[model samples]
Target: MSAVLRRSRKSPAKDGPAARRDIPPGMRPPPLEPMRNPGLSRARLLDMHRFLRLNRVLEDQLSALYRQGKIVGGLYSSLGQESISVGTACALEPGDLLAPMIRNIGSLLVRGVPPLSLFLQFLARHAAPTAGKDGTLHFDDPGRSIIGPISVLGTLIPVMTGAALAARMRGESRVALTYIGDGGTSTGDFHEGLNLAAVLGLPLVLVVENNGYAYSTPVDRQFAVDSLAERGPAYGIASESVDGTDVLAVYAATQRAAARGRGGGGPTLLECRAFRRRGHAEHDDMWYVPRDIVAAWEQRDPIDRFESFLVEQGHATKGDLRSVEENLAAELDETARQALGSPYPPPEETLRGVYAGGD
Candidate 1:
């Protein structure tokens, strides 16, 4: 994370004495326990670490560019919630579909989106997936089975549900995964989509990122239920809440959910409990969040926690992790330069793709 975006008052170690001091008693995370190996090979574990680091560092570079007035639109940072995206995405099979929200950029990377594509998209260069017409993650790669998110909240739930249904009809074993925020779960689309998926036993996994707030509204005000996972029972499907800060736990949960979907067990709802450490957008000042809460979550930073796990479990050394960071920094620097140098689409070219079969 960049210094410019680090608003937390203090950065405490994950298991240090000061870690939970500022956090509310009710909101405090449980004691840090040793994470069990999820049966991943040493190489795979290191790859997960690389993705986690890349997710954070890439956003840090974008945050810097946004501050310098280079990026075309608002940038959303998934700083503290990196684990959920990386963990869930890494569990997928080759042909599984992924529908990622604006904050789920890490998923795109895990699905093989080059960092250059993101930089170009954000920079609004002519080579971007949207051809410089749009400035956000409104582009998708069919080759990678990534469905770009629609701006309307909760809309992707139904879209991915349809995709899952289509795959089943075609006799393919592929599963579809999509995400929504805590506030988005209140949308009618969320209910309708999940209900349909349950009824038909479609291979769909819906991940609800319960990141404390939906924009500025806290989860408490958004729903009366004790936990979002409870809604799964109402729909007659399985549900579970996992520690979003723990990558291994999230990976395990997603693997089980994916397996259930593939085995004709219907959709599964996973509530990932994590906090959004930054504002909803780059322009918004996070005055709504209490400082102590942000401080507390910062100590549980997903990347930092994952790094510690890799070393403790003998999967990687400190030097190996440092090399990953250094290599990623260099790669991002080159990507930004290339994006900056790319030209924007010509005015006449804009009208060319606006309508089909009209030139």
Candidate 2:
């Protein structure tokens, strides 16, 4: 057997069977035990159900617009990977910082980016955040503690590390939550950011969404390491792996990591294992992905998985889940309609916000 295969079978501490075996009868095993220190209440679980469905509906609507050629650039959808963003975002406080990637629309929404704003950005209308200057997923609002991501992979790690440093300087008990792809862990900036964060003892939580592809390049071609979280220990940081599809597991791991960060502990590397059910963007046909691989991930679809967990655990009923979905559908429909109706940025206004004038 290959070394990579051997390493893949070795479970991390938090994801081991012992940590996950405490479920009651008829309940499926959790990827990780729910943390009591910051356990999720029934109300919070309902809220999570709402966020998960909200993200799915929004992404589906965007994809529909893309298919209709209304969207300007490539459209990325977080179809199978919604839970990681929603779960992690819910674990954070308002004062914390978040750096969202192309596939992190859920995280942005959870952090309070209105669906109207996202629709406007996608449509490149007059009131779009970048005034149509930016062609893709780039919308930053520092006042809301969210940093818009750049196109470059792995770069946000350093940006988040710096934000954590600044928070420390300001005496804010805040942590910076940043994300990267499995393929992103190969980039030099990933190492540099992590090393610096470790050395400076910066309060940062780095999430690596190991979705098994770097735009058609499989894990075998990306790196020799079996798991991306292995890089954490080398940098003297706390690290673990979680089932990204399991919303509760992701939330529990993130809650622990964020608490440690706020308590003067340095960074943590959380490798979330899941699969991206869509192409790198809407344009790609995903011909390279094997049929069986896609089929397997489909069985563990995050939203479906989480919904079942909620019902089986007696936290919610099927009707409750249905009501949440029904409510979000109306809200999303109204917001998207308004965004489309909004005016486009006038051609003459392109350079208005380019330079900062003396106030």
lDDT, candidates in the order shown: 0.86, 0.82
User: What TM-score would each prediction reach against the true structure?
Assistant: 0.92, 0.88
lDDT of 1 at 295: 87
Error of 1 at 267 (Å): 0.1
Which predicted model would earn the best TM-score? 1
Q: In candidate 1, residue 121 scores what lDDT?
A: 92
User: Lowest lDDT 10-mer window, candidate 1?
Assistant: 17-26
After superposition on all CA atoms, what RMSD does each candidate show versus the true structure? 5.3, 9.0
Model 2: which residue pairs collide? Answer: 126-344, 126-345
1-359 per-residue lDDT for model 2 (tens digits) = 23433543464535543243332111121244332324678888888878899999998888888988899887887888899999899999998999999899889888888888899899988788777778555989877899889999989999999989988898889999999998898899999999999999998999999887788677767877767778888999999988788887788899889999999889999988888788888876555555556787787888888888888888888998998888888898898899889988788875576558811
Q: Which candidate is the best by lDDT?
A: 1
